[model samples]
Target: MSLELNINAAIKTAMLAKAEADLRALRAIKAAILHAKTAEGFSGELSEADETKLLQKLAKQRKDSLDIFRQQNREDLAAKEEEELVVIEKYLPKMMDEAELKAAIEAIIAQTGASSPADMGKVMGVATKQLAGKADGKAISGLVKELLAK
Candidate 1:
């Protein structure tokens, strides 16, 4: 089933079960999807790739919000954001662990002949496309820097 359908069905299930956390997260996702459809310059066409990117973006946003909430000592808000983040993350591709990510980046560097940090842009361009949804940008960049420096 398409993710859109799953989101709608889950929303209904959440409502039926009176699952406040699930309901809130589902509603946020639905709203974001709707906004993406109507956003200016967007084609109103969300392919599987686009949807995956959307989910990743939402997860990142929730993580940022959760961070700020925790810093402010707002456990209640942080918990809510954490719950939503978990929901959003379930839809994203399984993230690559450090070992796997390092191996992949090593292969990419070898393929691209990235000998130094200066070639990071070239490596990153290809790596980002290759690793999209599977690895976070921060992790990729850090790994790339560490590998290239050596």
Candidate 2:
């Protein structure tokens, strides 16, 4: 099923289950999908990749909000954001652990013949493309920097 349809179904299920946090997250996803579908210059339906990107973006936003709330000592807000994040994360692919990420980056470096720190750009370009949705961009960039500086 399309992500949009799946999200709608999930929202209904959440509502029936009286899962307030899940219902909130699912509603947010539905709103984002609807906005993408109707955005100016957007064609008919959103591609699966686009849907995934949208969900990832939402998850990132929630994480950022949670971080800021924590920093500001807003425990209530941080807890709420964390709850939303958990719900959103259920749809994402399993994230790569540090070892797996390092291995993937190393392989990309080898494939691109990246040797010195000067070749960081080439390595980054390839690694980002291969690792998108599977790893956080900041984590990947930091790993690339550490590996290249060695």
Candidate 3:
């Protein structure tokens, strides 16, 4: 099923289950999908890759918000944000662990023949495309820098 359809069904389920946080997060996803669909020059439907990217962006926002709330010592708000993040993350692909991410980056660097820090851009270009939705960009960049420096 399309991500939008899945999200709508999940929203209904969350509402029936009286899952407040899940419902909120699902509605937020639906809202973002609709907004993207209606944005200037948007075509009929979003490709699967686009949908995944959008969901990841939403998940990132929730995580960032949760971090801020935690830093402020707002346990209640942080808890709510974390709950929403959990709900949103259910739709994302399983993320790569640090070791897996490092391995993937190393492979990409080998494939691209990246020899030094000067080749960081070439390594990053391929790595990001290959790892999108699987690994976080910041972590991948850090790994690339460390590997290249060595």
Cα RMSD to the true fold for all candidates: 1.2, 1.1, 1.2
- Candidate order, lDDT descending: 1, 3, 2
Report the lDDT of model 3 for residue 69.
Answer: 92
User: Cα deviation in Å at residue 118, candidate 3?
Assistant: 2.7
What would the per-residue lDDT of candidate 2 be over residues 1-150, giving only the tens digit for each residue?
898888989988998999999999999999998999999999888887788789899999999999999999999999999999999999887899999999999999889988889999999899888888889999999999999888
Can you give the TM-score per candidate against the true fold?
A: 0.95, 0.95, 0.94
Estimate the lDDT of model 3. 0.92
Ranking of all predicted structures according to TM-score, beginning with the best and ending with the worst: 2, 1, 3
88-124: candidate 3 lDDT, tens digit per residue? 8899889999999989999998999999999999999
Please identify model 3 stretches exceeding 4 Å from their true place: none
Clashing pairs in 3: none
Which 10 consecutive residues of model 3 have the lowest summed lDDT? 58-67
State the C-alpha lDDT per candidate: 0.93, 0.91, 0.92
Comparison by TM-score, 1 against 2, better one: 2
| Model 1 regions more than 4 Å off | 41-44
Judging by TM-score against the true structure, name the best candidate. 2
The lowest-lDDT stretch of 10 consecutive residues in candidate 2 is: 43-52
